[model samples]
Target: MRFYTLFFSLFIFSCSEVVKEESFGDVTTQQPSIIPAIQVYASNTDTDVKNGILYYKDTPYSGVYIVKFKNDRIKSKSQYLKGIKEGCTNKWYADGKKFEQRYYSNGHKVGVHTGWWNSGAKKFSYHFNDLGQYQGSLTEWYNNGQVFREFNYVNGRENGAQKAWKANGNIKANYEVVNGERYGLIGLKKCFTVKKGQDKVTR
Candidate 1:
């Protein structure tokens, strides 16, 4: 009788331990670490983060994808975005010149996209439509960094003149745009004679 009682007690304790472990596993499996709103992935791949990389999958049965950078610049950092060639995409230099864009539901480019510098200068800016057409003002800049002027676009064609200036503040350009075509005169700002023995006015 004594032996049987001792055996029963041991069995009960063993069952309790098993139950505790099962419950722990269930809780850990069902609940993941929560991420804040407006922030993208907080936990990726379930693998430990190391060497400035975090990986995740677009779906349970999808190919693994990754986000990589020099260090913890995750917000400014960009990735393949959702394991598709689509979604908010950004490309950048290590020194931080970047081209960033977003796409529509059908994977067509959309909205105001930009190329920028870490110094916050706008290198170029373009607006696009759902069909990936350039449908807005497209601006470019001089190397010394002035507005080289902008041309209005429609269906990826230039529909207006691009007026711009030189680094010396003189109007040095007049460009007509049509379907990425640039034609017409480039203002060289030359001095011209209006009358004899009179000083030349540069135009």
Candidate 2:
């Protein structure tokens, strides 16, 4: 009877030790580590982040994907649903200033998107449609708070007047796109001719 009792106690202790070791291993492996924003952006074309969706171990990821700066400050925080980006994704500069704010729905960009310079001045603002195409006016400003550029887009193609200004508020480019052709002036020079299917302004 004594031998049997001792064997039973030993067996229970061994099992408990095994269970504790396994639990610790699991915890360490499952803990997620913060990644850098530059690394994440570089990996955007990889399978894990392809098509604006996020995947982990070949499975759709659903959670907040966060990236940090080298200084440990939060660089960006984006929410994902069933692997697709959803809701607002916010980004910050290394100095903790808000850098960009954009919205996504079902992996597609939607609504207004805005960005700011490190100096806290608005850098750019634009709108996107549900299909991720540019819609409405897109405007950019210099770090000194001067208007830098303005253009209108319809269905992702530039249309109407396009204008750009230098940092000192001097006119840089003033042109118009009509049916995929450019006309007017660009920085005191005549606008270059664009083919019927090649209406694009080079910044």
Candidate 3:
């Protein structure tokens, strides 16, 4: 009788252990699975310039638009609202380095726009107004980190001094614009002819 009792207890304990393991497995299986975020591609979208909007399968798009390189890396991403670019836009090089960044509002560029060379050096910097016209200083740099060009703009036209330099730091073009006229020298021999609306130099 003691042997039978011992056997019965051992069977009950083994069954309880199996029940606990099965209960743990059931909980793990009932847990939710992770889901990835969705991405929209520009190529899959259609532009409607006349309506001033973008469409995806005939529906107005109001999310982030993405452009990717052939290698599946993100090339550019821009925010859109009601089919128009309405926020920050960023671009990246194939090697994953940032190439450019700019802001837009109501489909027009606003604020600062900047670009960088593949070598991680600043390439250019520009500013724009709400009207999408150039405003403030515009500067460009060579890949070797030398200043290449500098100009001031007011209302989309160059106003004030404009300067350009060679990669070796020598002056290439030095001029000034006042009231829609250019003055000073370009290169070594070319002279600027001041015309009513002309801003370029003639040899």
Candidate 4:
């Protein structure tokens, strides 16, 4: 009887120790130490950012994502599936104004993407299909809210009249594109003077 009781106590202690070790291992592997967000931005270039370079605890993020400013303001957030960026990824200016909004699927950009100037005016807007092909109107505006240029795209190629406007709202240029080639001159007579068989228009 004495020997049986001792063995039972030893068995209980061993089981508890095994459980504790497994729990600790799981926690350490699942919850990694987060790094400073500034490092992520620094890895990007001066004028643009290339995605998939962000890291969490020295490991690439592969799950739901939320990056915040030092002041606790949300700077950017998005979702990831198996290391591939998915769903809406959004960023904001320091003043809490939205700077840009983009959608991604399977790590590729898709759907409508929009950007705004720091002054709260829309800077540009465009759309791409699920296959990452541009398939709609692309528009850009001056910081003062005047239309800067407008063009149409079909399957990533220009397919219609493309036009530009000056900051003062005057027509800057007008031309047509068919099958991605400049079709003809349809601009100001003083600006675009076409010569016979020359295939050239001077501005």
Q: Which one wins on lDDT? A: 3
Best TM-score among the predictions, by candidate number: 3
Name the regions of candidate 2 deviating beyond 4 angstroms.
1-52, 190-203
* lDDT tens digits, residue span 84-186, model 4: 6666677787777888888777777898889999988999998898888877899999999999888888888887988777787766666888766785555
Model 2 lDDT tens row, 1-203: 99999999999877555421111101221222222122233234443766655786576676667777878887887756777777667888888888998878788889898999998899999999889999999999998999889999999999999988777766777798999888876554454433222334433
- Go through the candidates in order and give each one's C-alpha lDDT: 0.50, 0.72, 0.74, 0.66
Candidate 1: stretches off by over 4 Å: 1-66, 75-83, 91-105, 142-145, 176-203
Per model, how many backbone clashes are there? 2, 0, 0, 0
**Residue 105 in model 4: lDDT:** 78
Sliding window of 10 residues with minimal summed lDDT for model 1: 20-29
Candidate 4, residue 52: the lDDT equals 49
Model 2 TM-score relative to the real fold:
0.66
Q: List the residue pairs that clash in candidate 1.
A: 157-179, 158-179
Q: lDDT score, residue 183, model 2? A: 83
Global local distance difference test of model 3: 0.74
Model 3 lDDT tens row, 41-126: 86673644347677766766776678889888889887676678766678999988889988787889999999999998999999
**TM-score of candidate 1 to 2 decimals:** 0.48
**Cα-based lDDT at residue 159, candidate 2:** 91
- Against the true structure, what is each candidate's TM-score? 0.48, 0.66, 0.70, 0.62
- Give the 10-residue window scoring lowest on summed lDDT in candidate 3: 20-29
RMSD of 1: 15.3
